[model samples]
Target: MNIIALKSVDLAIIALYFVAVLAIGFYLKRFATSGQDFFLAGREMTAWVAGLSFLSANLGSLELLGWAGSAYQYGILAAHWYWIGAIPAMVFLGIVMMPFYYISKTHSVPGYLQLRFGNGASGLSAITFAVMTILMSGVNMYAMAVVMKVMLGWNIHFSIWVSSLTVGIYVAAGGLYSAIFNEVLQFFLIWFGALLIPVFGLIETGGWSGMVARIQSNFPGQDFTHLWSTLGNAQDNPMGMHWTGIVFGLGAVLSMGYWTTDFLVVQRVLSAKDIRSAKMAPIIGSFFKMAVPLIVILPGVLGLAVLPEKLVPESALQAGQHSYNEVLPLMLARYMGPGLLGLGVTALVAGFMAGMAGNVSAFATVWTYDIYRPYIRRQAADAHYVSMGRWCTVIGLFISIATAYVAMGFASIMDYVQALFSFFIAPLFGTVLLGMLWKRATGPGGFWGLLAGVGSSVAMFFWVKLNPGALAIIALSDHAKPLAEDMYRALWSCLINVIVTVVVSLATQPKPLSELKGLVMGVTDIPKEQNVPLLHKPAFWAAVSIAILAILQWIFW
Candidate 1:
């Protein structure tokens, strides 16, 4: 708890890192002269920058804290949440979703929705995305604040405000360009900082063999021994630990939702200058995702081996209590020397800032393009619209900071935030997927499907809240408790939504075939003359190879 007393050098490094991030923001402003440049990085990002930005935007303090707490409580089974949930979802999105999305040339997902579905569907989805992004932004801010509070001994509110303001200033000034540029820097720092904990942890515990021996000696028959087995069962394992848990916990749910559907990530791909870049962005990031468990989750396992009983403290036994979220911070405090600790702390701040910037940029895009442009006025100059976009960024940052303050009351910010998203995401994804793939899927169907999915997800959420014990019964009958509840509600809701949308759209009267041509063809007015051949060559295969390597790591490592 007295971490600050041990590392003045580390704190200084962290301070310098913050200054560098702000500097990067200012430097990127030159490119952000127009609204498109500000919101979408002028559609000129390379595959690597796009990829890193996508990863950094998605990887925030919440992931660091959540992974640590999950590993602490559940052992190895926690890794599944990332592997099954995120990686495949991302790959699928890149291969399947990006080509069409890029072809559409829309600025945001909701912008695509309007073109594909209609004004009603696009408006509703945009509003939903905006709300979800705002909520998620707050959750990320709250986690970042907690890290700052623990590492720097700063007041939580002040830390949140400072972090918010720093991110807001640049985002408002330069928009997505600033966010993406900072993201590239933050991604490396986060990767390095994350990697260091486990490296130092291994050294502190002796080595991989020594760490394994210590784990076996102390917590015999635990699945934490293998990385693959820790996916989903991280929270409730009776055995030492199971790789299946890792597969499910990290793999299935989290990965699928985040990689495939989340606007924060897809926005990066959508902003790419060309299809090849979009395809490669998530593919490149997948490698980073694969490497994360080694840096993030392994430390928790190492914590079990290295920390004295007193350090873990009993209060920390609960999922969200005693700041197990501080696992990385505590490990850095314990093992890192002064100057290095400052660098590590700086990396942490960078990760948080990158996440905030990404969210702010995404929020601004949604508000300005999707909501503000359509409803507020039909005609506005590009300059005027661009100025309004900056205002939206500031407004979004304030809303998120305020929400972060409210979220501090929750015991587990990650769980609360994810649960909140689940209510809307399931339905939204259902509608989007259907709208994209199914030609018969009408606007009414999309709208009703979303409504039905939301209604069912909400009803199920309340049902579980009201009758906690019933969940146990449902769990026994169901393969998974949390997933079962979610799937049951989501699937049924989607089914109803899809059915209603299809039936109504067909029955009410289909739009004329000529009118439907644009929607069905998935074309935009942008030039197709200069289209680059889909990079279905060796580089594409190499990207695929890296993704396979990631999977293999999950399986074997």
Candidate 2:
């Protein structure tokens, strides 16, 4: 993976892109007048910028690294994640959840929780989100660092720190404005670089038909054409693809949680000029989601066909590990020509930086608004808050760098990272979703639900951690591994949390109708027409047709 002798053109591209990102940060300084402006870009993001920014933030380096790994192991089931988990969830969030959110006029999702539930709920949600962001950011940072180390032969810790500083400088300087602008650039780079991999792999393997032939010749009866087959099986039959798990487990739960409740995403929508833009933000991004399998997941499938047997290190095989998330990077080094490899690596870095920028901005917002302003005395002026926000960004960057170093110690960075988030997000999403949609949901119920959900999730995390096989029906089965056990524990705990929240909300007296009237009625003092334009009939129908076509393509192809 020697990348040290990068071409002058590639180095120039990387350097110029970095400079452009920093320049954008400085260019947006004029917009950083008030706390709101710094945090939400004065609610002035355009639909295109919002859409690209939302997609780029979610595309983080972990996705590029981890998804390819998942595809290598799971075949088409990996693609099912985006179709099932992300697409429908985003659609629901846009049409149903987002309208209510925009009408609420709250800056943060947790702020909306406070209005719907109570201060306790808001505080709990904020803590959960902040913790998850910190942990996940660290994981993303570590993943990017791994890429840097492998591609450039740099020290891992040095790469981690360098990445942190590069992202922090721009985000601290420009806040949401910088994050969004840079995201647009990053999105294009990521899309281009990602698409190049599979195209090149297909070309190397002769063509789509040729690749299929080679796969059949090497492993006969394998259903490589179906985007829903297992890589290996015990009974000489392809394993069931777990379409339900991809749709429900990954798509519905993970994608919906992100599109609806995650502050990183909600912040983008909040920055929209009006409600219409908010609604359109996610819809526009969903179009990009439709392409992710082609750009990210399909490369791994192609890698399985093109990569030489000895390309993967013997150490990896001896560990009983088939999925090395680094497969994409390896493929780029081995297969892609020099110039293309550089562009692909640059795209990887761009995605990493975009994610880091988003996290830094979100961290600054939470620290300055939720934690700092509320608790600290002598309320700071707009200028002072902005300064504090920058400082907080710096501090957060350091913490992420440190955590990335720690995460490198893990056996599998993506598994540890995702599992950590599920523990917090599953319960938190349940509480937030229940509080918002159910009128009977009481403030006390929200509070208690937060406590119960987090408590149960944490308890289950530890229970599975200690016993390992305690939840398994049979002793020491394949399902009893730590990662699988943790996922099951988190899933069950989330379900329990939702049930408790709903049951308690129903059993108890509802919030006063008067108190709940504002949210229930969906009334805002702002005139409805002031919002962005709704999708016209033709556009709406076209979008629906596209969605259906995407699903059909997945099914039939």
Candidate 3:
């Protein structure tokens, strides 16, 4: 079952995929000569290219293997991460946020913060985000290594280094251009590799209704199919998460924070050809995001139907020591024969590489623009910064390699990542929300509020760690897990940020409206098309995306 034992055709397919990816990196290397070229692809990407990369950057191991495993462990409730968690926020970014992002001409999210708030907030964000991005990259690397060890029987350390080295070389060579191109390529490969699992799984399970009936029959009185049905209260759900936490914590805070402010995805949209393309990118991505649960989540549910005993042992139905993260690999091993199996493994590898590349690319951009250029070298040439970006990529990948070793101590890759996001992103979003919408938010207010929020999250995290019984705010029932704790922590941290920011802003002097032009909502007007058809408008497409999401919730409800 290991990759070493794969048939020649499958191994060939995997080899060819690596070659093609490397070829793309080398091919795009020439275009990455200047800072703008290296960081933003010279602002030349089409909507579809940016959109696919935007979606595919996130489609890495976390979205693929993590969510699939989540489906197995958490049931249909996992879809919330994709649907309510991603789609609306992506649409929000396209319709409401992209104009400011594009018009500001900022190379990174921290750069935007510098313009909207000041250097204090921007520098803190840049450093914090740079660290968080590398850590997340390590999460993907470790997760992929775990999958490889389980499926291919490769040495985990060997797998980690090989993947890390390959990603670092190419990303350093061609910068964000190579990352975006490969991300689009990985998007196709992921779909091709994963779509078959659910297709064959459905056929094996006797279709949608048949799978539901089989799961019920195999595990009597167990409810694993409905999305909202299991979420009435803390005790009602398998995840021990209440609707309030899920809707507000995940959907409102974490999702918005990640989608709107996290530079990893925003960098993709910022690379688009124009403002329209920037706005359209996430909207196009949202369409695909809405359907991703079918690819990632359904496999876990399918595992429940096909391999329930394996996924959840008799000793644990809701909680288990069994490795549920193997749901995607298990399903692939179950259905895919030689040639197809290689492609499947390649897809997984591609996802891992893409995730790592995306993080490192964002890290390089933020480091070069927000930190190195502004703080270290005040007037470096564009070519000099581009070289610095390349060097930063190398350094960032090394840091991620170190962080991957750190992640070895964690139990669930997804939970570890979520905890990190709660600590950094959730509070960052609180500051971003105010900076963008509330013109009165002062630079001092933004900086201190973000610091307070992150400190609060860290304090809460350690407090709960020292005293498990102290998680009353997060736990709906005694059965609540770390995942629930993360959601509640995000909720509290975000509230603290808002409260501190508003109080500080009220006490401090606000920047004049003239100084806030184009950055603040009331001070600036996003371009409006007077005569374009509704279908062509970004707002119209956002509405369509939300409507589709509503239908999905109802169907899954």
Candidate 4:
């Protein structure tokens, strides 16, 4: 059956959503004339605005479709990405890193690297990030098109082009403000659309216990409800990842790399109106982020309980049939009727646009501020930079349209994203972490260490492709999927970055402490959440958040 079960009311709701998005774009255009306004929303966003945008930008079609599909394929182990892989890192950003980021007044993450390391380090990061951002945008575009093609029977090319054009027009006109507002709007719509699935699903399956019972009956001997139980070994788990890989690779390296350094989300928090607001943004986002698994992951678990045939490993190879990626859309089609169905489809579409917009906007900022201004045109006017940002948006979307085809080659959107992160973000995070905390890290050390890490990561990636069984340290099982390869690859890359940075820094001259002030952890004065009660303090809240996560993990285990 076609996923488009929309009626007149449903079509109206979807139409109104598009009109509302365009209206927001037009409304915010005037405010985005200046460079800061265009790139950072004039640094005037409140905590709620920035926080919601922070969470919502990440709650894209990638998260909705990709992770839901991951859940269907890998069971509760997929929840690790949301919980252990995210919450702590987000809290760490709010409490530990935001002070340096805000105080330095860097326009982007690569801009921060320029201050802490040097332009060489920053330039490498900027170009790499700009490429990754557009590729990620492509992933969102491709994933959305695939969903629409499967569910609505729309032409995949038509879907991609329409979404690209719509996102490009609005984002070009209004800049970051348009992206954030639309992201917040998309957030609510997705929740309203997706919440019904779990609510109705739980009831249909007779609640949590009953759902578990049904999943077990459908796939006996396979535990789909426990998060950590399957992590005893690579082959024991549904993800084919051992606890070391999950904890160290994904939980520590990739999670922190993404939450702490990825400019696509960090740019949202950096736009906060005040230091307090900036600090509060990620903390607030972590709260909402914690609840997102229910809306996304539950649908997959429910699919396991009721739609097991669609998730069978060989089912996709049978041709002209649904696969794991279709699980969310399939669930929506099964549960939602006309008007609600339209709303649900709109929610998914909104998510795709939000992801694409996040990447493109981040790319524009990095291109204009980090690359174009410094390397290309050193003395351009603010208006010129703003214009450049607008142009980059258009070009970036076109590049994204091209990259979307690359994403089509992957087994799944989630795998492709993880691969990209391993290639860039893991090593990038190590460089950033050393630069931020270790005052001894010289510019040369930072630059060369990053290069070595990236080079070695690429080499190892090919080595694995040639012989997956060779990496016993990574616990690469013969039956393991690409996701496991990504995890271990990230772990090795991070280790290489850290070791090289440390060794090279020791052999070189350290910058003066004066130069390192407010940049390195030792010399930097951490900001306090002043005048707030104990419960309101960031440290206290971080502790509370960690406790909650631990309890949840234990329960799920």
Q: Which is the leading candidate under TM-score?
A: 4
Worst 10 residues of 4 by lDDT: 308-317
User: How much lDDT does each candidate structure score?
Assistant: 0.69, 0.70, 0.88, 0.88
Model 1 per-residue lDDT tens digits across residues 302-399? 87787764234223445434455667677777777777777677777787788788888988888899999999977999988888888989999888
What is model 1's C-alpha RMSD?
4.0
How does candidate 1 score on lDDT?
0.69
Cα deviation of 232, candidate 2, in Å: 15
**How do the residues 218-300 of candidate 3 rate in per-residue lDDT, one tens digit apiece?**
76787888888888877766788888778999999989999999999999999999888899999999999888887899998
Which digits, one per residue and each the tens of the lDDT, describe model 2 over residues 148-210? 766777687777777688788888878888888888898888877767778778888898778
lDDT of model 4, residue 212: 93
The candidate 3 region of ten consecutive residues with least summed lDDT is 313-322
A best-first ranking of the candidates according to their TM-score comes to: 4, 3, 2, 1
Candidate 2: stretches off by over 4 Å:
1-4, 216-225, 228-244, 310-323, 409-411, 471-487, 507-509, 521-546, 549-557
Error of 3 at 34 (Å): 0.9
Pitting candidate 1 against candidate 3, the one with the higher TM-score is: 3
Clashes of 1: 51
- Check candidate 4 and list the clashing pairs: 3-151
Error of 1 at 57 (Å): 0.5
TM-scores for the candidates: 0.87, 0.89, 0.97, 0.97
